[model samples]
Target: MVTVNLGMLHYVIDHVYGAFMHRTKISPPFFSRGWGGSKLELLERLINQLFPDVEGQIWPPNLIQPMWKTVWESKNACLREGVFRTPCDEQLLNALPPESHYARVAFLTPKFVSPQNMACVVHLAGTGDHTFERRLRLGGPLLKENIATMVLESPFYGQRRPVLQRGAKLLCVSDLLLLGRATIEEARSLLHWLDSEAGFGKMGVCGLSMGQYILLLLLHF
Candidate 1:
């Protein structure tokens, strides 16, 4: 019927699959910064209308910071081995900007920081897989540039295991899609917090494979 490569699979995962899963019917604000600018803007506008009160909130204080001791250790391993398990704290598992409000949203914080750079570029991994060697190769330049980085375990991948490991038993992709919306909302909450607490303003997003595809959809519709 249809030929599928990693690239194609990623596209379906980000757009078709992701959309079906994240069916909230909220419109996003439209703007031109990258691609699909208009559609994402419309969707953002819709989200804002639906959730007007979901304003930017402050990040949790050190005391309230969601414990990620396990996540922290796993992140260390990701530094060493590329991919790490998802943190148990599901509350922290969302993307910033909530897609509800058209706030200045940015994803991923660079491992490195450089004042000379005005723009931050991010990389998104596919299938929640990476090798320590790959991280070393890919992460260095981004770090040098001080680009922000974020690692998301897509519904069935990475730290998104608890929900996905059920394997065709409990929930299918459709079920996971609902979870995906929650993840996006969570991400938005985190983004708002970062904006208020970390002082990171609007920046660009560069998603590899599925992430890129998602970014494209974000740009278009």
Candidate 2:
């Protein structure tokens, strides 16, 4: 014979129910579907091997000029897009085409350029998101204040998505890890480019979901 405390039993039942619903819910997609425990361990080892001892400036050592091509011009704002080529932290993939081995950025700036004291926000969209949600949100408001805006499409996203992948989100966890490695490096290069440019002395970053988390990580990096 056993006696169960009603309060404790209710709490345990609620937690169990919540956990079941959480794992069963399909609204928030997962990128690690094909990654098994062993594969996750492999990813961990690879990361440790590459970054066992790391020390360097986040900005690029050699700041280079990026060719900014105006894709769209309007009375309110202008859009400039360009690709910045840089090496990844590791050689995970070989035989990548020159065009595919680069990072891209789109700059949406006010029609009027202020030499100084102008604000600029770097907008990072969600992971696997083709839509520039953050840019769309900030474009109008920021431009109203005479601020500039830029969007960075994540690696393995947008046109950068691998042809082998069927969807926007990655199926292989290892591939996703590799993308993270390169994306962070490319983001650092972006900072270098911005630092050299005028009116970027004051900079801010905005992101959504995973992108928001990336912004937080960039602060520590």
Candidate 3:
């Protein structure tokens, strides 16, 4: 008789699935462009300047106010889709690919709840998560708790993905760093909007996998 470890089997299955899905010939491997020379240098300089041997020293000097354009609304007005320009600083903005300049967001809330009576949580993306649909569905059940979900479409995925890049595989190593920095800036701005402009009583940020790492970095500020 052969005994198989269920956990190990499960891990093997996951890896096999991921390999087929993400490592195919049609799907380019990440960092195909190698370590981007100038871009990597710029990022390193920025990091050193921001940190300077001090913990939690990095923070956005100003949050750009989002000018939202509504894309859609549920008939009951509980779900809405909107987009705004990414609130990254000029230096970071110039570094980003053109398509990633704008950010898309989806809001899911319980109808008839006042902003002060409800809470909103901004959801960040895991690796390769390209759309708001998955996050929206995950958040939908929380409506019963009067918690609203704000799903952010990350740069380098969905409509923001660079044209030359294949699927979620970034073209350069520096692009990964760029994506994280841009996401933090955008998320901070969105949280500011929720607190100051929308007047939500309570707010939070959450993410999965890579997004969780980004959330940890966001906490530094």
Candidate 4:
């Protein structure tokens, strides 16, 4: 009899993925452009300024007011796809790629629930997640429990991916910082919209891998 260890299989798969991601001709390692001059400095300054505010009890004021429009919906209206502007402030907008200016989302809910009685969770993207499909599927099962899901399309991903960028590997370290900053701002604004505009009773956030870190940052404000 032969015994197979699943743990070893998992490591094998991970090794294969790592090789494809880092050693392939088509796939570029992250931060391929190295640390940029002005953008890197700007990111450092912003981080220093924001670090102190994270400890404060008061949440930061919402700056983005996204006007959402339904792009697609199931025939029964139980699920829908929507999009809106990323709600990036002027300073952040200037630093982002033109293609990443808008944000996309997928909203899932049960048909009979009212917004006031339901809970909604905003799902952030992981390192390589470029679409709402995976997150939406993960949240779909909760519809029966009256919990809705909103999957956000991170900047530098999905329809927002920059033309020059390849896959999920960011071109520069500053781009990673920018992506994180933009995602946090957008998620916070979306939460505000869910509470004040959409009138959801309870709100929360969830993510996977890299997204988990972003979720933690969001909790600070």
Return the clash pairs for model 4, or none: none
**Candidate 3: segments with Cα more than 4 A from true spot:** 1-13, 17-26, 38-43, 49-77
Q: Would you give me the overall lDDT of model 1?
A: 0.38
Candidate 2 segments exceeding 4 Å error: 1-33, 36-41, 49-64, 90-100
For model 4, how does the per-residue alpha-carbon lDDT over 118-214 read when each residue is reduced to its tens digit? 8999999998899888998888788768899999999999889999898898898777778887898889888888887888989999999989999
Give the alpha carbon lDDT tens digit for every residue of 50-162 in model 3. Answer: 33443544453345555455555664447777788887767778888999999888888887889899999999999989988889888988888989999998999999999
lDDT of 1 by residue, 1-221 (tens): 97669987788778975576457634222211233134656546544532335234334312112223222223212231122222213333342222211211213334343323424333443434432233335544565455545443344433333432333222232323333343343344444444554456654545566556554533321
Name the lDDT value of residue 171 in candidate 4.
Answer: 90
> TM-score: which candidate is best?
4
Highest lDDT: which candidate? 3
Runs of candidate 1 exceeding 4 Å displacement = 1-125, 128-137, 163-171, 217-221
Tell me the lDDT of candidate 3. Answer: 0.83
Kindly give the stretch of ten consecutive residues in candidate 1 with the minimal lDDT sum. 97-106
Superior by lDDT: candidate 1 or candidate 2: 2
> What lDDT score goes with residue 39 in model 2?
60
Query: In terms of TM-score, how similar is model 3 to the real structure?
Result: 0.83
Cα lDDT for residue 143, candidate 4: 78
My TM-score estimates for the predictions, one after another, are 0.40, 0.72, 0.83, 0.86
